[model samples]
Each structure stands twice: as structure tokens, then as C-alpha cells.
Target: MYAWAARWRNAQRPKDQRLRDAERSGRPPDQRDQITQKLTALMSTTPTAHGYRHPNWTTPLLVAHLAREHQLEVSARTVRRALHGLGYRWKRPRFVLSRRDPNLRQAKGSSRGD
Candidate 1:
């Protein structure tokens, strides 16, 4: 009943509907904050749930998994959200190719000279 009433009131208003906007982008300030918090928590812990130890994924890996496997519109931004929500504390290198930067790259190259 309250939801219907609120919707009716919003419908009467001519300007952008606050309630509708809230529903889409998360609104009511408080509710959005709460949901963001929840989503953040979920994102942080989702990896562990899926047996993944890392908090973030490489661009290609993320695209293939989130977009293709999970079928979610989980762009980098969304991934950030999940990380933020989860309060993730770990980070793994992405594209840290040994050839790209000698100083950073530490791939399994040939054994160092004795």
C-alpha cells in the first residue's frame, strides 16, 4: 500500500520522479547507501565464494567471466563497486609481463646466471 501510494504521488509530480530514480540508480540516499554497502560486501567476498583468492581480475579475464560466463554487465566500474563493497584487501598484478618492463616483470624466465 505504501509503495503504491508513493508511486501515485510520484506520478502526479511533473518533474523527475525521485522514487523512480531511486528505483533505478538507488535512491532515498539512505537506501542507496545501504544497498551500496551490501553490494560492496558481496563484491569483496564473491571471489572467495567462487574459490578465487584474488580480489580483482585482469581485463580480459573479467570480461570473459563477468560478461560472458556470469552474463552480468559487470564492467570495470562495476568490478570496482564489488571490490569496494567487499572491502577487499588483496590485489594481484595484471599484465605484469616480464618483457614489458624488466624491473617489474618477474615471469618464469630462464634461471638467473650462477
Candidate 2:
């Protein structure tokens, strides 16, 4: 296009600016920073404290909570992205054996024919 040619011809423009398309008018800001902040705070507390049955927080639960409390309409994907940006990683809960008996580990292994 002529516009692209003209833009490339301008020697005064920064090299980085040429690598991407120019910013244009678009949708209004989604206030992601504020939502991220709220999510951070919410992470500190359990869902039960907020009248939810589940103890852990899920993406859908977070989205519903935001809609209910902050009246913010955002997708679970957005919440996940924000969580990723905040350096949060998803880890499944692991089953932990109770320390009821000191020889429980030995008994378990022996019974399994190991």
C-alpha cells in the first residue's frame, strides 16, 4: 500500500515503531489493573468466608464473584491471564498421609509387595 511505503520512507521514525502497526482508536480500557488487584486480595481469603461452599477458588468461581461483588463482567480466560501475569501457577491438590502411625509407611510398602 502507498501508506506503508510512505511510512517506511520516513527516516526520522524510530525503528521499533516500524515493526508494529500504529495504535488506533478502539474499545475503552477494561480496568484490568483494578480487577487484578481485587483478585489478589480475594486470593488471601477462602471462598467459604464469602458465603461460597467450595474452599478453593476456581476461574469460574472468581468470575462469578467479581460479577456479584464488584459488578465487573470478565471472562474466566481473562482471570486466568491475570493470574498468569501475576506469576501464579496452577497446582492440583495432592493427597497427604496423616502422621498417625510412625510405621505406617513401612506397613504400606510391605503390603504392596514392594
Query: Each prediction's TM-score against the native?
Result: 0.30, 0.65
lDDT of 1 by residue, 1-114 (tens): 798567767756765564444536655343335445544444455454756675654444454455554455545665555556556544665585454664665657767742
Local distance difference test, each candidate: 0.53, 0.87
Most TM-score-accurate candidate: 2
Q: How would you encode candidate 2's per-residue C-alpha lDDT over 60-87 as one tens digit per residue?
A: 9999999999999999999999989888
The alpha-carbon lDDT assigned to residue 101 of candidate 1 equals 60
Ten-residue stretch with the least lDDT total in model 2: 103-112
Full-model lDDT, candidate 1: 0.53
In model 1, where do residues sit more than 4 Å from their true spots?
Answer: 1-56, 90-114
TM-score quality measure for candidate 1: 0.30
Model 1 weakest lDDT span, ten residues long:
27-36
What is the Cα-based lDDT of residue 39 in candidate 2?
91
